[model samples]
Target: MFAVAADDCAPSDPTLTVQAYTVNPQTERVKMYWQKANGEAWGTLHALLADINSQGQVQMAMNGGIYDESYAPLGLYIENGQQKVALNLASGEGNFFIRPGGVFYVAGDKVGIVRLDAFKTSKEIQFAVQSGPLLMENGVINPRIHPNVASRKIRNGVGINKHDQRRCLLIHTGYDEERRVFAEPAGDKFL
Candidate 1:
């Protein structure tokens, strides 16, 4: 439950401090946390890819941001014996992976952790699991993708079922990396 909050635009504060913890080295996932100068409370802010050098130490950069977004990652700055961390997704830091059941706030253009396991399909709709069933950002839901299992097409001058058509496409596209997904029936492939 150790956490840290960070924002680049925040003014000087005497109380807040930034913290980081190792999550998974193989995945380069590191958890960042923040706390007050008076040691009252603390919480997690985000997880980022830890760039490590040959010495196996995190390459702490004064500049940080999301991988796909335009933003600057900020560290802790203490003030007024209280803590204030920026949660701006587009301007400060990168995307955050929130723990399931973890507390968070999502403003406009903000993305949060998504949990897919909680999704309940109605009337047996077909869908595929794209990612975690844990925490999700806003507008994210379960079954983001559908397992392409079959297709229909004319084969050998005979009309074939979707599944059969998929098999033919798979054979044709097996070696084609770019056309592999669309070349065959989508249902036949699974990630």
Candidate 2:
């Protein structure tokens, strides 16, 4: 796998802070979680990290998918090759229902982003999470998204490395733990 130079990823807007980590399915242990084995929901990232750390697995964690009132994933959620929740294709308010929403998945040592209509189940898929508006695919941004739209909030997405198909970047923007705004919403361009 190849690593892109940091200069290539420098955000256009200096004020919009982006934190990213490179993940390769073959070298790193990537898993999705929403609850404990005891049937209690891990309602927040802090709670999930604490639980994992208590078991001596102190590692980075993030919550980028949408969840409902009970914290259950609103779309497809899989764990260790088992589907926990089926894909969601219903009409709804907000970003989840945007046309051509997609799934981010890990299959064996590879990762992929595919439009919901194009998603398929396979034995090779180790983990998957459905979320979107399928921002961009194959170097093209989804046409449904406005280029200069003012609507913004804390958001995150996975991007495949152009240099290495197996490598993916977990990207996030907006406020930090202390509630400081990193990516201002009013900017003309993306952070």
Q: Rate the local accuracy (lDDT) of all candidates.
A: 0.23, 0.67
Per-prediction TM-score to the true structure, in the order listed:
0.18, 0.78
Inter-residue clash pairs, candidate 2:
none
TM-score of 1: 0.18
Residue-level lDDT for 138 in candidate 1: 34
Q: Which stretches of candidate 1 lie over 4 Å from their true place?
A: 1-29, 32-54, 57-141, 149-191
Per-residue CA lDDT of candidate 1, range 60-139, in tens? 22211111222222312212222233322222221233222212112122212213334332222111111111111232
| Residue 61's lDDT in candidate 2 | 56
